[model samples]
Target: MSHLAIIPLLLPLFTGIFLLLLREQRIYIKRTISGLSSIALIAVSTQLLCAVSDGNILVYSLSNWPAPFGIVLMADRLAALMVLTTSLLALFSLIYAMSGTDRQGRQFHILFQLQLFGLNGAFLTADLFNLFVFFEVLLLASYSLLLHGGGRKRIRSGLHFVVINVVGSSLFLFAVGILYGILGTLNMADLAVKVAHVSPENIGLVKTAGLLLFVVFALKAALLPLYLWLPTAYSQTSAPAAALFAIMTKVGAYSILRVYSLIFGNEAGPLANLLDGWLLGMALTTIIIGSFGLLGSKRLRQQVAYLVVISAGTLLTGFSLNSQAGIAAGLYYLPHTTFATAALFLLADLIVQRRDQMEDKLEAGLVITKQKFLGVMFFVLAIIASGLPPLSGFLGKFMLLRAALEHPALPYIMAIVLVNGLLTVIAMARTGALFFFAAHAVDTATNTYIKQSEPEPLKVRELLPILSLLGLCVLMTLWAGPINSYSLETANQLLDTPAYIDAVLGKEAQ
Candidate 1:
């Protein structure tokens, strides 16, 4: 289709570089540039939904180089949806962050924009090597951003994130090299074609490499056992930082989903079949573990971290179905989980900060009034996070559970997920009990800062960002049709490798 498809990637890339060139004292200009760039990015991503919704995959090759030599960027229904979700989240997060930050001044915005560039590039790039490049671009920026405020705690977590990713990046490189050496191409489309020709023995080796590579994804997605890094990092970072990060793990999940379908598909080459077979078991265990974590935890921030595991489990369960309906449900649930899980974490962060401020003030014998509006904001976010009906989170789970029940194996799995959901409801109830229902709200309510008497409980600035995000959640819930339909269609596209294979490699040899 049109080359405009690449704007999602280009806009952020140049904007980030431009910001880097600013003088040492242009924080306002930096914020302005970032804000405008973000608005432009959002606008571009939305226009794409309308442009590509009519059943066409937009492909733009970089430079004048043809398919195999130059990098290719594609805008399919799936990719556009992801880009749109990421852009909106980034925009809201930037808004929230701008209100309060002790960052690298303007550099903070630069890195944030850089991070967006990488995310957009990852979603749009058609080449496997290119995908790897984009993943690093984002990951490195994230590493820097995570430690932006310069705390020993955040730095500690940032190091873990960096070291682990370095390992994953190494593994990914090895996997790509193996794939290209075997398949003679690094283009995802090219590999999709040449994959079948590698003998059964070779396919086994390839699958081994694939699984190795997938482990990297699993680690990034914070799948069970591999999920230790998230809670600490999210907890230590700023609300906006945590909020933006909420979307990062999903990128890993998205990559794994694509790789699983593209290379192995239904034919299920050696190692791929095994992963295909065991995904349900892994998902089930992840859900059980995550729910139990939430159940055992009293802290709201910790509970939200556990919820990340819950979403991963849910997405994995959908992928495990391995059927059209199952895949469709997984695809449909991706954005819903992306929004709900991350937003909940953000809301939790905000609540905890307010509570901490009050506690500090009370210790100094200052009386403070709790803001009614902030309480209401937390209440609304809590309900949505719990997957209650009239919320998109509920509809996502509903679709997935329905899909799971249709499969014989999935019926039992769905039951477990149901239990998981109940546990989630309980964890959310605990948050409400702790924050709203307890004697604490009444006995310890305070708008005053411990150190300063004039501090307000809930400033309008703090309340509006979250409210706007919550509004988006409502819109998604109310209009699940458009999003759901596109997800289902994209799922169809994901399951069938031939169309994608043909796109990159042209027709296969007879």
Candidate 2:
């Protein structure tokens, strides 16, 4: 009965609505409102996490309706963690936006809040159909945000993004329709129960629906074949949007983890482990492709985009193991990649801002102001992204590899992951050298180092958000012990299917 589960959804919902009603000219007020709302979101999400930290599954039935009939907002450790991650990222992204990026579009604040609303709701919703609704909400807000600056690159990428997601959304609805028609319930807990006992005649339809859901989630997660739309869309979008999008791919990974484990899990009789065979192979392929993309990228933003793909592939690989340790490793790595990738995007933009004509291209450009500071930041991020020692990325990847030691495909998993890490290291080193070390005078005879003009002085306010994100990565590394312990507990809770079912549908139903 705790209301905390619903607050994460409601706070942003109302905040977005209020921001929409305000006049756009009152820009300062709008920024203040949006910033405060994001801060409040962090607080509320923290409370929700604390509430569920003790193995509690807090479910709030809409309108006091009972299970399987009512729409429910369920906050378990997993959902709470995701909500918190989204909130933290949103706040930092907003701070970065406030540094002039928000001016690039109309109603930036409103759309930002709406996007948070959708993200928070998507994490907390317990019903399958409501999940689709939240997906649309987030996608709608993202379409505008992606094209916020209004340029040819953004438009082209936005159109591709829009078309792909629309098709994915259609697939999601079709899958949901099949599930509801056959199972008579769209509540995930109920579906889990019903899917286990599905009659033989309907098994084919159920399997079809399940595979369709997997495809939709993979498309969202940007798994290979369906990931064609992500690099362009993500790399071309504004920095703040790109940074916020660091968590977007994780949503697909999260859905795959949730739906596959809960509904078609080991207890699903014939449908048990339906996706197990395909997930590992696809995940490895995704990693390989992403590694190649990193080497192939000609720009910093695009390289960062490919890194996101690799992270997703790694995450799903862990989940594919279907073991507690593997899932725990993925959970720990999730936030690390998110923070690190986002920091890189923000930093890339900062570097591009000072390069004048060169932007983020991986070619020699005029040396930027604050070269020393930016160089150090990029170096730290590079180490983290490449999964080098003493960082959260390394620890997370280590745990995953350790967890996979017993799997039949251990060698392949290790090979792909380790090789990807090496490629990432090479890519990062090359990018850093080009941006920081390769700069030379534009006029050799005159020995002119500056661009048409010296780039604008670097501002502390602009660096603050990027630094904050990096600081989070550092803290995550320092606090790995407790964090990993928590991840393990969450993994345990996730694998405890009966507990989840009983909590949602009551012990009688289970």
Top of the candidates by lDDT: 2
- Model 1, span 1-510: residue lDDT tens: 487789998898899888888847557777788889999998999998777787677878778576777878878777888899899888878877777772444478888888999998888888889888998998889988888878898899889888888888999899888888877788776665566556876876687677777788888888878887887777676677777887788788778777777766654444344475566777788888888888876466677778877888788788778777777777767776766666766666555565554421112222223555655766676667667787877787888888877677766786787788788787676556555545232334455333433435565556666777788888878878977787778888777677776665556521
Q: lDDT of each model, Cα atoms only?
A: 0.75, 0.91
Residue lDDT tens for model 2, 169-249: 999999999999999999999999999999999999999999999999999999988888999999999999999999899
Off by over 4 Å in 2: 443-452
Residue pairs with clashing backbones, model 1: 361-450, 368-446, 368-447, 369-446, 369-447
Question: Which candidate ranks first by TM-score, i.e. highest?
Answer: 2
Measured over all alpha carbons after superposition, the RMSD of each candidate to the real structure, in angstroms, is 3.5, 1.4
Steric clashes per prediction: 5, 0
Score candidate 1 by lDDT: 0.75
In model 1, the Cα lDDT at residue 476 comes to 78
